[model samples]
Target chain A: MHASLVVSGLRKVYEGSGRRVEAVRDLTFTVDAGELVCLVGPSGCGKTTLLKCMGGLLTPTSGEVLVGGRRVSGPPPGMAFVFQEYGRSLFPWMRVGANVELPLKQKDLSKARRRELVADALESVGLADAAGAYPWQLSGGMQQRVAIARALAYEPEVLLMDEPFAAVDAQTRADLEDLVRRLWRQRGITILFVTHDIDEAVYLGERVLILSASPTVVQEQLKVDLPQERDQLRTRVAPRFAELRTHVYEQIQAAKRGEPS
Target chain B: MTDIPPEPTRPSAWGSLPLRVLFVFALPALLIAFWWLTSDGSTNVYWPPLRTILRTFPDVWTRARLRADLVPSLLRLLAGYASAAVVGVALGTVIGSYRKVRAVCEPVLEFLRAVPPPVLVPVIMLFAGIGDTMKIVVIASGCVWPILLNTVEGVRAVDSVMSETARSYGITGPARMRAVVLPSASPQIFAGLRQALSIGIILMVISEMFAASNGLGFTIVQFQRGFAIPDMWTGILVLGLLGFLLSVVFQLVERRVLGWYHGLRDSSRRSS
Candidate 1:
């Protein structure tokens, strides 16, 4: 497994209102290429701040983010981010095809290739017919799909998603999670997914890294030994699935109590 | 005008049809009714009846000579509006992006915005001379503030999340403005444009009134001097009609251009 990203001792401090707030501290992690890892934590646990640092959307005070072995000073060109607010993530004025096409345009791809990629990305999200439709015209699920298509069309080496399915309905969230898994497997792109949903993390991540709330620290990284193929019904009912979920749940409980692991 | 509505047609017609029908007919009908009632006698010489105005309208509308005057006034209005849009948007973007620029310019712009357009007419007339250039300068100066102020508002109000998302994609500079910033700010910018257009029309009519050999304003004054009441009424009615039609046309274009934007539920819709 090749490391697609390396975060070493990352920290971010924001100053305002006559005070200082440390959002993240002493964070270190590495994601291998084509490896899907989910960061699970309580709300306001600096999960977003950590993602921003990793993606180069925010600067860290005294640390570095390495993408494909190069230190990321600003948003690294090879990584794409899918934000939670589908309402805001996609540009409302551009057509769905154009929204997906925008990031690709930044790449050195030819116009024909760009067009082909945009078309394929939209199709993969089950939004093939929505190419000409604007972002506002689609339902929430469809809008999120457009956002995904935008990230996918960039053909980023690593896709960092921050609660990408939180805003959508539960049914849509399940479908989207499956979609992410399929895309990760098919493209072999590294993924760093941040979510507060324990089931979602366990269901989607090859490895789930749980963190403690407020001044977050990594509590544990649990390897999911479930079979490669997953199902909503059959797989969820298995004994190993329950055991894995219980173990992750206990870790979270321990985190909440500030208990020694 | 009869075939199209200026406002968007939303799904579910529940009372929307009648509301739109009222929007279509109310203002013009009310204006006409006022003209008809007032024309009964010269209760106030400034006001004239709809019939008298309608009868006198053709004399002004049909005259081949009046077109020259109308054309010059229109040219001045368009030049001023175009210049304002270009400069206002350019300056607005800069001022909006940079805090220091905004702090320096905001006070000066506010003072300019407050100093009514009529005061500038005389000053511009002196500097630019009694030509179309003077009128254009005055009109452009008069019209620019609203567009600039509104552009600033739109740009300042840009959703930060969108900007961050754009940055994450390595989108910056002009590409970011074109793709992310401009579209996000457009609804507000167009609002400014709409207001500027209204001001432009007012300045168009006013500049002609201040001093012009032709144009609708000049025609009104010239007729009043000759005691052509009907002709005077005709010119005023024409001004009213032009203002109404211009607003409708603008709204139509705004809706078409901002189709994606207007549908966005005013954004705080998450609560609903």
Candidate 2:
């Protein structure tokens, strides 16, 4: 069964060096079941911190994150997080298949079932042949794909990706974006993707959640009015796509200028 | 920029395997030839002829209970080194993972590490007696520091993201250590093990030298004291060969263990 996520009045304050730096303040948002939502923000705007809080990786100073209506205390069940640093995220010593199959070890699945899932996940990411290869043997984009395959193999109801495509080149980034959308549609998994790139957020998300600079809060929630059946070429060229991209772009620029939303 | 000439390509060292082997052996071969020629018939008290030493090697090694002595020394070395490796890696993981433990134990460990193994032979002899136990203890004490320190460094230096990934995947406790932590720290641990090997060898010799026991070190010292120059040279030569052989075997194991690390490093370097 798929799950949705809701974050309410979330605030995280880092108490270090005898000073408290407010990272995320009063950040409130929701992603409905089977919906793909992107949270876009400027650099150093506490997007990663907020995502960490939502994923239950970090304890918030106040407020709460609800996954499938349950408060998140530790890493929430039925939810997986894909970090931005793919190189650091994947185990270098593990082969591609082993890396993907790691999370499944926690599940009460038979060896055959686990193998099947690993194969399926690798095939989905187009890394079926690279299963025996180590992560370091592959290129950056291929490594990130292995990471995505890892998340996919977990068979989570919700996937939280933090700037997943940011480290790759332009061509690879575009290819990965399409792969994410395809996976989302095929599995009906709720996806909460975070990124600093305005175009990436616009290109991926059905609903783009704009976040302001620190102390961070939701600035705007812009809905993409593009067609359900979308392609990178036709969908991006649509006049509606251009309008939405501009709106998100202007919102980020204004947020950068410290304008109160 | 236009006037700058392109750099010339150096000749590849891998032109031929046989040629490369010959190149590496040329100096040692020449030295051996010189020694053989100079000392063939000379009757120096300390400086035994290479031929005399070579002739005595088979006699000492086969008939003079040298093989029996070799067994005890090898066994002690293996026992001490193995125990050290196990204890070092286990304790290192704990200290490295926890900050409080590291802070508490670091000073005492540092003090112990600073004391050379040879110096402690007398102290160990008094406590353990000049037996197999004492020799093993000396080797273990001497070799543990490198492994422990390297493991601590390796575990501490493990990328936080890797651990976080493991945690996110619900891999924690012993599973986390076995799957993520150990593998990540292996390259460094192997490096520490390499350092420990030579130290173990040195301690093996030192420990035997001090006590009333049978070992290569004891044999060497006995031969020297009795003015058996050829036999002493044979012992020295055998010890040197032993060191060389151990290192070669160790390198083969290390290569297998750290094959992934090397591959990753090479690929990244090539890309960069």
Q: Judging by lDDT against the true structure, name the best candidate.
A: 2
Tens-digit lDDT track of model 2 for A109-175: 9999999999999999898888888887777888898999999999887799999988899998989
Q: Each candidate's TM vs. the true structure?
A: 0.92, 0.95
Candidate 2, pairs of clashing residues: none
Off by over 4 Å in 1: B1-9, B12-23, B30-34, B41-50, B266-272
Proportion of true inter-chain contacts also present in candidate 2: 0.53
TM-score winner? 2
lDDT of 2 by residue, B1-272 (tens): 01211222334657987988999899999999999999988878899899889998898888557557887889899999999999999999999999999999999999989988799999988999888999999999999999999999999988988887887778888889898999999999998999999999999998999884699889899999999989999999989999999999999898778777877786676678
Query: Which lDDT values do the candidates have, in the order given?
Result: 0.82, 0.89
**What global local distance difference test value does model 2 have?**
0.89
Name the runs in model 2 displaced over 4 angstroms. A1-3, B1-13, B38-41, B63-66
Give each candidate's fraction of reference contacts reproduced: 0.60, 0.53
Model 1 chain A — which ten-residue stretch has the worst lDDT?
A: A132-141
Can you give the DockQ of every candidate in the order shown? 0.50, 0.40
**What does candidate 1 score on TM?**
0.92
